[model samples]
Target: MDPRIDFLYLSEPDMIAAGVLDAKRCVEVCEETFALLGKGDYLMGGANHNNHGMNIVFPKETKFPNMPVAGPDRRFAAMPGYLGGRFDVCGNKWYGSNHANIEKGLPRSILTMMLNDKETGAPLALMSANLLSAARTGGVPGAAARHLVNKGAKVVSVVGCGPINKACFTAIMTQLEGVEKVVCFDLFLDKANEFARWVQGEYGVGAVGVDDTEAGFRDADVITVAASRLRPLYFEDEWIKQGATILVSGPFNTDESFLTSARIVYDHTALQEAYVEDAIASGNKEAYYSGVIGGPFFRLIDAGKLPALKDSTSLGDVVNGAKPGRADLKERVIFIACGMAVFDISWGFELLQNARARGIGQSLNLWERPHQG
Candidate 1:
């Protein structure tokens, strides 16, 4: 065995230097990962091997005197998974989040990932995962954009112009051409305007802030919703034009007609089943899935409109050539991007491998010998 072992430390800047924000590459890596997922070469937590993992929730009222008070989006979670094919590795992303961080001018979530040795359960890299998480989160839909949307999708309406959506918008722009107009909508108009300027400056596309969400959706050939709203989705189906593709990266709401007619797709059916499992386990299906874009589909199944949950197709199948992405250009498709940890690991693994080859990131060595007898 080698006498010494060192893992690279990737700060945010190091991640940038290592091409962590390159959505184009992240999308490609995710494409491969999805292909593998379609082939059943992956394992996530839970009885179905597809669970999204258990999220730690906080109480509004704390019993412990010294415990921190609960706030919105304030919780901790551990997402663990393993990929099988060529990139046979296992790991987890652990993080604590607080929506109140914005009051302190900080991001809502602070995340980190540990790449592990498959056999020994040792960490290969303790790396910053903000960009890693953001890119993979955005890149999945960007890959969907490649397959689902029409060839000449000129207009893209961004429902949420936050950091994650920024990554999503940029990545879709890379694959799409003649995307001259970008319409943005956010509860905070200033953030939307700021996003507009950034998009215009970065991609040379025309960015405009629209007061009406429906107006933003009308002319858009592609729509991406990445807001942080927790309530039921209120976006009306009347707002979405025919022949448009909707990529939901955040929680959303839709009508019964749209839910029944539109082809409901998922990044992975198991991930959503994981949500159902969680709902059944916690007896809170209505609370968690009710307002979500996918929530309406579950409602339809309950209402006997759509088929069972198992009937939906996985995006990986579309990517792997087993199923078609857009059956016809006029078909309206709704893809709920329930993010998976394997995606982060898959792209993170590729980036780490690339960084090692290109000599990117800083390296630190652990102790030379074992501390315990």
Candidate 2:
């Protein structure tokens, strides 16, 4: 009997060649994924089948000299999922992150993804996933912008000037038309200035750097917050104009009053439920709320400060026409997207297929004969 097994290995360059950086196509694919999610055709890690992923975090202090202690953004994680539909595949993303990587001239997180055949559980492809991760992460907001943002929205305010926000801007540009300006705010003035210049050069939009967050949000039609923070960053209700949509891909900093008043939408309702369950089970509810981007809202619901989450709609529902998106120009909407593993699997699967069609990756033989069974 034939026993040969092989898998495709794709480096970052190969992933780029396979169209990993195609923001428009990535957004479209993400939309498809969201629809599948709404239909319950995906399975993520955890008992509830809606977990984001499993992470291994080190302690802040370790007695052993060889033992590693945790620092900011330092952890190892595995994000696994199965996405069914026309694209039936299972995959896992493995990444290690250390904030100090920046000091070494590298990104804080380095990631790789492995796609497998659902039926056989055989490796299909192993690929660099930093770009895949970024594109899919950005595509969530991009897809929301397509359905939620006001048409011909002219001004966009970006609160973070990091790589993730850069990808978000690229995805937003792909999905929206007539975006005339981008105002950026960052703690580091130089980073904000650099991002402003980048936006101007890349999208030819009028880009400005602002010292104050309020100035960044003033008169903005769409606001995206992608900043990484351990503590909440507050956005006063007065800063948000009527009819503006805020896409939150990072930790929320606003007060309870603003959240209760805004039309809240989630990337997926079940995922948020899972987050709350996990937080409660872990016994430090407040820490989870403060640490996670969408934690506060769920915490408020748990504390009876806000209504139950059933009142909110999932972006997937909107994509599938199961619910309405952006009822009126006067309505204020805030989209909270806690990144999902399905996105990584979906995009990785597509990239793998593209690489195969283009003959863009190396074929590595797993074995010529079965080692067991």
Candidate 3:
């Protein structure tokens, strides 16, 4: 065997050329990844194998002048996982996020990903992952929309007008047909109008910005909450249409009543359970509710107010044909996504393969020889 080692480096444009922005394909791969998760063919960080990942957080007060202080959406995180199936690859996504970055004309989170050979532990590729992450994040809801959305769904309600939701809208429009209009709401009306105009120009759909959050939900067939909220926003059950499907990609957007009344589905049950376990062990059960999108439901389960794990179903089960999706037109469904590292690994592996096929990325030498072992 050759002892020389090299790896591919893909920039954002290289990734796009390698089909990283193909929303429909991303959804298909995400569905397959979920099926593998259902079959127990994946390993994430932590001993339980379901941990989200390791996050580095700073304290609110620091004695050191150079040390960063805690603020909104500020932290460093490393999400590592190994996925097994047709694509057996290990990878980690590293990101530093600060909400204040927006003022400097940068995204809140800037990410990079590294894929490895599972057996040999050698680097295969290092790629810019902002688009990869957003596409996979949006693909979860796209997959849900494919399986759970009612037929002839005409209107889509979008709560947040950020880059993440832009990817989500692209995926949704690609997967679902007959989407006629988009009703959008944001804390900044200017942002909402800007996103609406983009949707109109990109998808050729009617887009409208609403001043009221409730107005955005009226008569909508699908609702997506991608807004950045530091506190919970309660929605009256009456505000939601009977057949509407709500996709939540952020924290504290809905309340316990809506969750209890809806047919709740999660990307994965064990991951959320792991969050609950961590919160309890840390002696702050309330943090689970405040920190996670599905935390309130889990808190209710802990309090015995809701059935333990019975009132909800896993999206993987639905994907694997073990459970049904959207049984009736009037059944309101809520999909809560906590964002998995397996998705990044899966999509990154595919992008790397595509880059190799298309001869798109730069090749960098890792070592001239195997110096150790």
Candidate 3, run of 10 with poorest lDDT? 228-237
Off by over 4 Å in 1: 2-4, 230-233, 291-293
Clashes of each: 1, 0, 0
lDDT of 1 by residue, 1-44 (tens): 75466777777776777788888998998888899888999999
User: Worst ten-residue run, lDDT, model 1?
Assistant: 227-236
Per-model CA lDDT versus the true structure: 0.82, 0.89, 0.87
Q: Taking the tens digit of each residue's C-alpha lDDT, what string does model 3 give over 302-341?
A: 7786666645678988999988878899999988888999
Question: What does candidate 1 score on TM?
Answer: 0.95
lDDT of 2 by residue, 243-330 (tens): 9999999876776778888888899989998888888898998887778888878777888887677677999899899999898998
Error of 3 at 19 (Å): 1.0
Q: How accurate is candidate 2 locally (lDDT)?
A: 0.89
How far does residue 68 in candidate 1 sit from its true spot (Å)? 2.3
Measured on C-alpha atoms, candidate 1 has an lDDT of: 0.82
- Predicted structure with the largest lDDT when compared to the true one: 2
Error of 2 at 100 (Å): 0.7
Q: What would the TM-scores of all predictions be? A: 0.95, 0.98, 0.96
- Model 3 quality (TM-score): 0.96
